[model samples]
Target: MNREPLVSVIVAVYNQERFIGRCLRSLLHQTLSSEKYEIIVIDDASTDRTSYALELFHDAIRPVANARNLGLAASVNRGIDVARGSYIVRVDSDDYVNANFLHMLSIFLEMNGYVDAVACDYLLVDDGENVIERVDCSERPIACGIMFRKEQLIDIGLYDESFRCHEDRDLRIRFDKKYRVYRLELPLYRYRRHDSNITNNAEAMRQHEANLIRKHGLDLAASNGMS
Candidate 1:
C-alpha cells in the first residue's frame, strides 16, 4: 500500500447558503497538493446563493447543481459516481474541517494495512462558528470525517436513502461488523451547531436517530430459548 494517497473530498449542500462558502474555503485552503486531490461540491438544488457562491471557486471545485433538491444521499451518490480518486470522503455542507484533516487522515490510512476506514475526533462549533467544545472519541466504528477505500463504501451499498440523517451511524454499524475500523483521537472535523443545521433540529434529528436505531433493531440483550 502506498504511504501517501490522493483523496477526493466530497461535500453535499442543500439550502446552506450561509455556511457553504465558509465550508468550501476551508477545504480549498488545504495544505495538501492541489494536484493530488480535488474538491467535489454538489449544490443539490439549493434555492439560495449556493450556486452563485460555487461559481466563485469554479477553477478548484467540481460543482453540480440539480434541477431540484435530491436530498443528501442521492446528491452524495452522484458525486461518488464520478469521483476519480482512489479514496472518497463526505463532508457536511454546514461544517468546516481542519486544514490538515485529509492530509493526516490519509497518511494514517496508508500506514495501516488492516484499517478499512479512518475517523478522527472533531471540534463542535456554534452557529457563529465559535468553538464550543472538543470531543476525543476513540471507539469502534468511527463516524464520518473518515478517509478510506471507496470500494468498501460501494460494497456496503452506499448511503441509505431511507435516512436523511443518522445514515452514517447506521452505515458504520453495518460496515464495522465485518471490517476493522480505526479511530484517530484528534479534532480534525469542525462540526457546526446552529438552528439551521440538521442536528440542531431537535425534533427531526431525534426522529431520525430513533428511526436508525429501530430500523437496525439494535438490541443489547438476546433471549435464549434453549435450556
Candidate 2:
C-alpha cells in the first residue's frame, strides 16, 4: 500500500529551460524522504526546451503540460487542484532550495498546528546562483518559500486566477483576514533574480498592482479601520 504524501511541492515553470533542471534536482534532493512528499511540475506552455528538460525527469516528477500559456496564477491553481498532500508548498522552476527546506518547514507546520502557514527567509540570487542578499520574510513575504495547510488554502479560495502578478499579495490579504502566516526567519530558500524575471515588466506590474488595490482596497482599508 502506498501512503499519501505529507507535503506536495508544486514546481511551476514557464520558459525556464536553463534553470528547470537545477530546480527539479533541488527538490529531488530534499532531506525529506521521497515517499513523504510529491513534486508536481506544471509547464505553462513553454516555447523553449523547457519541455525537453522536464522530460528528463519524467519518472521523478508528476508533469503537466498546458496546451496554452495560462500565466502563473492559473498554473499554480492547476497544480493545487490536483495536489494530494496534507500540506502544500511552491518552488518556481527558476529557483532552488536547501536540502532541509521541505523537511524543516513541514516539521514546523506539523508541530505547530495552530499556525495557518509557515514561511522561511530566502536568499535573493543572481542567475549564476550567487547570493545577492538575504530577504527577511518577516518584513516582506514572497510567494515561494512558504508552506500552508492544504485545507486552509482551499478555505481561502486558493490563488486568485485573475491576477498575473502580485497574486501573492492579494492572497496574503485574504489569508491574513482569517489566519496568520508565521515566518521562520531562516534562509532556507533561494529566489532567483534574472533579467527575464516577469516582475521586470513595469507596465504589467503597475496595471496588476492597481487592479489588486481596486479589488481589495475597500476590504484592506476597512480591516485597518481607516473608515
Candidate 3:
C-alpha cells in the first residue's frame, strides 16, 4: 500500500448486514486493478451484525467504526477525511455495482480533466436482485454512482452534516454552484429498493426537502409558476 490509490470507494453503512456483503463483493471484484483503488467502509454504530460482516473482509478493506450513530453525511465526511485516493465515490451498503464501475468512471475522469465529477446511470433492483428499471442518473440522481475529484470536494466543503436526508441533493446543489458533474449514460450501478430505505420515510424527506430549499434560497414555486 505504499503507492497512493487512484480512487477510493467510500461505503457508509447502518444496520445493512444483509446486503453489505454483496456490495463489498462487487467492489472487490472490480475490473479496476486492486492496487489502483481502495475501499473504506464506515460502520455507523450499527446494532446488527454489520460489523461481523465487515470482519469477513477484514484483510481487503479499511474499516472505520463510529462509537455512535453519526448519520450518513457525517459518516461520509469521515471517510473523505481519511481517503488517500485522487478521486472518491460513495457506494451505499445496500447497492452493488457492475465489475466495470470503477474502471469506467475513473477513466472518464482521467481523460476529462476539466470535469469535476462524473455519474453513471443505474438499475433499480429488488431485494432479490431483480432489475426493475434502468434510471438515467441526470434525471433522477441518487447518492451513489457519482465519482468526484477529492480535491474539488474539499474545495467546496464536504457534505452538509445537518442534512440527515437528501444530503446528496444538498451536496449536489452546492457542488454545482462551483463545479460541473457530467453524466456517463451507462447502467453500471445497481440501486436496491427495499422497505427499509431511508427515502421511504415521507415525513423526514419532506422536512429535509424544505430545509434544503430554504438553505439554498431556491424559488421552487416561482420556477414551477412558469410551467
User: Which candidate has the highest lDDT of all?
Assistant: 3
> lDDT of each structure?
0.75, 0.89, 0.92
Clash pairs for candidate 3: none
> How do the residues 69-163 of candidate 1 rate in per-residue lDDT, one tens digit apiece?
78887888888877877788788888888888888888888787778988788887888878988866443222348776888888888888777
> In angstroms, how far off is 119's CA in candidate 3?
0.3
Q: On a 0 to 1 TM-score scale, where does candidate 1 land against the true structure? A: 0.87
What are the models' TM-scores?
Answer: 0.87, 0.95, 0.96
Candidate 1 runs further than 4 Å off: 1-5, 139-143, 220-227
Check candidate 2 and list the clashing pairs.
Answer: none
Global lDDT for candidate 3?
0.92
**Model 2: per-residue lDDT, tens digit, 6-77?**
999998899999999999999999899999999999999999999999999999999988999998989998
Candidate 2 lDDT (Cα, whole model)?
0.89
Better of 2 and 3 by TM-score: 3
